[model samples]
Target: MLFNEEIQRVFKSDSWKKVNKKLIGKMLSEYMYEKMIQPNILSEEGENIEYSLQVSESKHYHYIAQKRLFDSFDVKWTTIYIVENDGRKEADSAIELLVDLQDVIGMSSETAGHLIKEMNSTLIADAHLLEKEAKRSDELIHEDYASLEGYMTGHPWITYNKGRIGFGYDDYLAFAPEQQKEIQLSWIAVHKDLASFQSVEGLDYEALIASELSEEERIRFDVKVKQHGSEPSQYYYMPVHEWQWKNTLVQNFPEELAIGRIIPLGKGEDRYLPQQSIRTFVNITNKDKHHVKLPMSILNTLVYRGLPSERTVIAPKVTEFIKGMAEKDHFLKEECRVILPGENASMNVNHPYYTQLKEAPYQYLEMLGTIWRESIYTYLEEGEQAITLAALLYEDHHHKPYVESLIDQSGLSTEEWMEQFFKVVMEPLLHYLYQYGTVFSPHGQNTIVVLKDAKPHRLAIKDFVDDVNISDQDFPELQGLSSEFKAVLRTEAPEGLTQFIFTGLFICHLRYLSNLLKNNGLMEEETFWSLLADAILNYQSRFPQLEERFKLFDFFKPELTKLCLNRNRMVDYGYSDDDDRPHASEFGKVTNALAAFQLNRTVGSN
Candidate 1:
């Protein structure tokens, strides 16, 4: 009885072809009966069917109807008329009813609202499930990979706990434990010598007369007594050349000798290396009065040793060139050597390079020395060798055979090393950018990749000058650097020098990481991107500088997120849609909603 001639009109339209007309009509009837007739019929007592009719006439029903019928369609069509007729006209009218019904139901507000809500809920749940899966995957990765001790403040040496993959620094003496004992022994010996000597009791009258003897007379008497006290079998004193005695004094106690000392200057510090030494040229005036002058060579070495090998080479060369210019320009050496310490104390007595010069002269002889040591250690362990500039680039390590041997034995490929290097150094850096609004640029030769235990694992990021970005207020000393450094490190600039580093080191290296991981079957393409997105999101959540404007996860949105979500739904779940166009549209809507949520959250917090 509810089947009107208008329903026939709905069948003629193009919208009717998109869906089964019978199914649509059946669903519509079901919904109407459930809302209007069934509830009223099931009611007891004085409840009226008229009330159900009134409810059906309510504005909400019409609103839902409009939404379900019209908003649901990709292309919209309006309902024009509902006609009823008999005979041949009835069949024509039936087709017309189908056509009109097609437009109305195809763009249904109720259906659209139901589907949108259902899809959104599913996506949110999927995102949460994906997050859980990612966390589990991360745990698996950590389990497979070896862990090393991380650096800590206020420690002399870090403990590399092999089992737990934990690290900590304690109050470690700079020298080896045995070496420290040796130093203590030396100090005790000096104290014992000082203890044994006693002065003549009270200088009696006879003693005074003995003391009053002329300098030559005293020397002769002293010589005679020394001769009498000598052993009978052998003379105690041996003849020495006058030149030898004079030369000994001159060489050992020269007017300008390089003074160096190994001491623990800072007290109560843990993990302090005794290798750090203070060295300077001391001008000995009358043995007591001396002037301490710092040297450029020593300063350069100190700074160099503190950096990675790659950076050490570059920094020293630049520093040496600057020093040469300064010397030519008659610049005061003191000005060049000045260093600002934490306190207001100006330390002019010690050379700026004293730390390196006194502690590890051999270590700072050249940049190649450090690289050689690292490579040799890897080679002995039978790990993946490092491809140094020597073999691949056809250049020897400063033309040194020993250095070349170290590189050859290491057996690490440059590509592998670079891959590891980016992971260790560049990953943390991008994370820093997300959190702190800045990072150090580790471009050029400042980057180093090292292989360990047959797997490329270590990445050394160097060059703090062009790399580190601290707020101007926090690090006023940085103001002395060039304006380029300042601008690149600024928070406001997009695609600044800092971003260049991110794009170069992090984004570009992603492909390499993917290849390596995929080759080993460690991760698939979808998993790789998901992992990357998770890393970025985690970094942003932790750092969150200018979070409203900065969206690190956005980079992976349309590609990675869609792929993961759509793939999972299509492959695992049976979502059979003929066009497949709805999937993309669904993703777009979801992205829009997410963006809106982010914006709203930002606004609400403010």
Candidate 2:
């Protein structure tokens, strides 16, 4: 039997047919919404709508949509119909959709062709997820946090989220999150001259080794290096994603291999599971061991999955700087309970040639590295479970929402449950931006909300250093930051930093939860946004002393820039080069739905 039988079944079942249709619907709906293509609305009635986008003179596609906030649309896959440029009609196919849109989005034949392959890879993997029927959201809510993450469908906002461009069929079964396989990471002995290691002050490389590996395992590994005629002192031990080792590193580093500079020590016994972000693996065997973030050269979503040397070496400092600020503030420490996972250590091996290219694509320089991020389990209190905030919207086969079950289990009214959630997640995030000028990418994958007795008790945030950034106009709180760390930490205006929250947390994440809760009849949409407004206001009331900071990092602007993730993927990601990694693209504007509802006079003041 395949390791993840349920996922395997999805590929062999008819249930996935509908899911595929829905996916097609999603691609078309979101592409149009992002203004990648404009569609002509053919008809509309109460809850039914029809629209079509022209690909060429003789070809176009049409689908039904259920309109949503910010011009968002939930496409009815069953209704999708396509008319070929040849004047023939048929149902939608993933490849056909991309081919048709090539001219409309200004997609080069090369990019569109490559994108189609990625889309196919993503669709097949998604079919595996849909192969087996999922547990009901209510039932899944009762499962432990980590196990529950295995059920997520993918990013709710980014239209083509599952585009993991490099995996083949066998690789998908072995490494993709849907497979839920416990992979044995390959350990390597990189020559000290070619590698650099950094860690938090007390936790050195040796300590990390001892903690992750058994004494027997450690001795065997050390002895293996000696047998290979290399002392442990002369090399920096690092973990490589097994696939990358076989496919990229080994093939690309022939000179190092010939010189005995890059020694392969084989696999570590510590088993891990790929988290939602496939490149970052969770230590399932130990649970307490640090989560390892490694570079995978696969094109997943917007960027090539790799760790840059600059970001890797200085990750710990980013953690230390941010954690210290949060710990010092009594309100943040006590009432808010925001958890910042310390990125304690990192090891990065730079390519001899790529590192020299000052203008090379970032991916080439990022091809090999590992980051040790503290686990959410490490921060959990007894009886508390940590679940990705994205998991809240997960629907079972029966379409039951997880938050529905959580509210029931907590014995709180739906409104109260949502309020507590907002207080735990939003308040501390706002505080970080307003007081410290620190903004984190609190996207679904990076944010974990801790539940105690079924209520949101606290929040744990990860992806430190690379994903976390500070405003360019450093506030007084940033005086303690190291010049080395600050040099790499991205800086922007406080207004731009709001995108870290608005686009990352709100639009990409909470928007789905709010809509799900309302559609499921758990809570009204107004109640959802109102509770959020109250949380922001209440947090502000507690920090009257930081009034100027509030104005600088304003979250209540009437119109905020709506980041166009789909558009960016179709365009250039970060930079345009085979050697470069992609980054999120931003365009257009979205109305801050909460601006008109400043319904928090009881607590917050302007």
Structural similarity to truth (TM-score) of each candidate: 0.24, 0.93
Point out where model 2 deviates above 4 Å: 1-16, 56-60, 83-90, 572-575, 578-580, 599-606
Best by lDDT: 2
Question: In candidate 1, where is summed lDDT lowest over 10 consecutive residues?
Answer: 152-161
After superposition, the stretches of candidate 1 with alpha carbons farther than 4 Å from their true spots are: 1-427, 431-437, 443-445, 449-459, 465-492, 519-522, 544-606
| Residue-pair clashes, model 2 | 3
Residue 259 accuracy (lDDT) in model 2? 82
Error of 2 at 69 (Å): 2.6
- What clash pairs does model 2 have? 10-131, 58-85, 361-580
What is candidate 2's lDDT per residue for 1-606, written digit by digit as tens?
545654555555465466567777878767766878778899999878888777778766877877766556667778888777556565546677777777788887777877877777777767777665567766777776666767887888766678777777678878888778889999888898999888887898889877877888777778878988889889877889988988789877988988889888888998898888888888888898988999998877777787877888888888788888888998789877788889998988889987677788776788788899887788888888889888887877776887888888899999889888998898878888888888889988888998999899998888986788898885787776677777889888877888888888877887778778877888766778878877887788888998888777776778777678778867755225655445566677777867756635534555
Candidate 2 global lDDT? 0.80
Instruction: Score residue 181 of candidate 1 by CA lDDT.
Output: 14
Q: Mind giving the per-residue lDDT tens digits that candidate 1 earns over 349-370?
A: 1113422454334223221111
- The number of the candidate with the highest TM-score is 2
lDDT of 1 at 559: 23
